[model samples]
Target: MSRLIKNLFALIPAFTYRRSHLAPPVQEPLLANNAADSTVILGAGIIGLSTAYSLSEMSKQTIYIVDPASKACVGASGQCEGAIGDFGVENELSPLNQLSYELYQQLAEQQSGKETFGYSGMDVHALSSHGFNSSDPHLPWPVQEPEDISNLPAWLKVPRGWVAGLIANQTHCARLDPPKFCRFLQKECESRGVRFLFNTTALSAATDASRRTLTGIKVLNKGSKKAMNIPCKNIVISAGSWSEKVFSTLFPSSRLRIPSTEQQPAQDWIRLKIKKPRRSEAGTKGSCQQIWLSADSEDLDIHMSSFLDGEFYAAGGFVDLSDIPDTPDKVTSPSHVTDIIEQNTREFLALGLGETVQAVGSGRALLPRLTTNLPIMAKAAWDDLFPSKTKLQEHSSPIAARPVGDDSDVAGGVFVSTGHYLDGFALGPASGKVVSELITGQSPSVDLSNFGFPKADEESGDSRDN
Candidate 1:
């Protein structure tokens, strides 16, 4: 029944945008005059939305999510693969990964995630061309579904040099429609009194006299070209790749900066439908099982395969250094970029499979990334933003002067949560929970001591980064 439900949900097609407005939509859920207890989140991507959703449960302060995009999740999170599993088990972020995976389970139970966001556990079949017996694995090993590569449908293929094996079983992993899950999160956030300010750009931030804390932000309505000040108690920047721009604009003279060498990393996506649907044990429609195979090691390019709503999903291909646009709506792929993904998808299904499929719903989405490949999930260091002029004379390090493990009231501060790259979808919930915990002055479920703001003084050139 679970498999049946998954296929059924996948059969329903994903939605596309239809811009009905000559201009973008108006901002909403604006706080009343003289309000100073609200938090303004600086992006509607998954991280910001998740933060808002989690924050709503912890506080009654009027929450406003501001985004330059007309709608939420138009960036990385909205277009994620939604394939989730226990990641970082052996790394520094293991606790964070495990905490997020558990939160996903808890949230699924609380929100009927299966129905709301199509969350369900599934075994991940890993395909590799390394050898007959797999070599050193890049992912953690957890098996629930027994290996049955021989029984795979004709539409699925095991390339000439590749052999298939179960890497993660149902107990450790799951998949969902990312777009659907994002919309579901947005609705949940809205229901909890979180107001969304779509088509609104956060121009800059105002700080108090001490230059230590935030006062509010100035946002411009794209449609009306009108700028307004929205007073807030705190600020959260989950602006993905745009975090640096927001930070620079907010604190023009601040020495602090988000790592920003990378730009406009995109994932080319395509969906294929089998000409003849296969059947399963109970005579229900069987979609193609998920398979991921890396074709390159240096470039790290992999072919992604999964089934959603009767369509085989493939999303893997990386583009580098495209111009990062001013807004999410303005982001686009280079011509024929998705054609490569579509071409690859058709070729993979036909390789030794002799099955024909229809490829559709092809597009590319710009992803958020950090050069350090780690998330900056901490509050802005008050000292870093305003370095003491006498610091060098006093021989004091600004980085050392900053506070550590601060869980105090942000009454006039800001929080930054971005640069998860491909793991953004899986990590969004935990990041949101942590930010909410920070705002509420509670101990974070995952320790963020290492994921602090980067400082030039650090030997690694990034202060406890990633």
Candidate 2:
């Protein structure tokens, strides 16, 4: 059994090499002319694309995805490490995580012959300061002692008495090349008659005269200064950190509060290319090994993963969010990013790992984090007191109604699905599924009350219920 395990590990590099080169199937021509009667999806990140794909599969409406970036997943989605699993997730979110994993499995099965959105099952290890408990129910894998603590991989730095927990290899945990996955989703959505409008920004939403129902959106084409209206029956906002900004443009007066979504502090990431050693030095200290490490210490948390292509991805060190630029292109201090890379490398060196740095960079756009640490997925509401069918002249008039809350009777056509924060990729598919169901008036597959918008009392700074 041990010999078989070694042999299987040896074949990983070759398998990864082959998989990396496999091209995704060609995409069909985009149906760009279907904007008028389409469902406009603002933002082309994983959340938006996944929602588009789900909607296309269940409905025949034309899906129009609009984004300011040149392509999808250009923000936090692209910068992520692409690890998707339920480990360390809160209990409330586990169901969504599980659902997403199942959806990904279905997607992989559908594309049996193609590169699988960079999907691969992986073994994960968590280094904890506390002793390992083999009987922990939360741990899907068995706890095992490290094979060689003294001769551990040069890149792993753990305290002498720290315990290592090995997640069962058969667990649902997985990893993927995030950008590749995003591209695959885009292709899938396109093939299903979804239209994409890249390099275009959704300036604002247009609503009916009473401002009770969303009717369309005003978009600005970056390539051409031409502006146009995209009439849609429903509007779905999955713009991540920018969700508030997008929604506010439509209902500026509606105090539909979303807990503040702030950008997380910037961190540094480094990619190191391990050089192949000579045959004589094959099992030596410099030999490359696939390592997946998640270590939590008093001061910092580190996540590092090594790929089959002799590349190691490591991210660490947090700086104030104010230190980073709001846009990816405007990162003023490259040295700061480099400093973080060096700091992480030093930690790896402490573990005796020899790393030859190939690339050092920082994510220009900071990741958005929500205060509640739960995603916001719910419909917008009009003030209940307002006449449902006010004349066009009173469209611009304000109406007195109870604040936006779960119990409010106002019903609007806009749906919000954001605040997944760092778990966007892990929860993207499930979020899309639920949002699609809500749009179609179908029952949600899972209870989404926890992910729904904050109730009136919660939004008003009153937590008496809790």
Q: Which candidate number maximizes TM-score?
A: 1
Residue 57 in model 2: lDDT:
81
In model 1, where is the ten-residue run with the lowest total lDDT? 5-14
lDDT of 2: 0.57
Q: Kindly list the per-residue Cα lDDT of model 1 for residues 114-150, writing each as its tens digit.
A: 6777676654565655632334333224323435567
TM-score of each: 0.80, 0.73
Q: What's the residue-level lDDT of 6 in candidate 2?
A: 12
lDDT of 1: 0.63
Q: Candidates' lDDT values, in order?
A: 0.63, 0.57
Per-residue lDDT of candidate 2, residues 1-466 (tens digit): 1111110110000011112222323323444444335688887777898899998988888788877655566665655556665454445777787788788777867875125565655555555555556554223234555544544444466666666655434254556666577778887887887878766777776655443555677888778887888777678888776676677765566656566534443444555544433123211233333233334442334446644333555555444453333223233235566566556554554322343454533343334445675678776654421233343334445542423332233233678888665467777888899998887778888888877777655543311111
- TM-score computed on alpha carbons, candidate 1: 0.80
Backbone clashes in model 2, listed as residue pairs: 141-168, 154-352, 154-353
Off by over 4 Å in 1: 1-26, 128-148, 151-155, 159-162, 210-213, 274-288, 294-302, 350-356, 387-410, 457-466
Note the clash tally of each candidate.
3, 3
lDDT of 2 at 337: 60
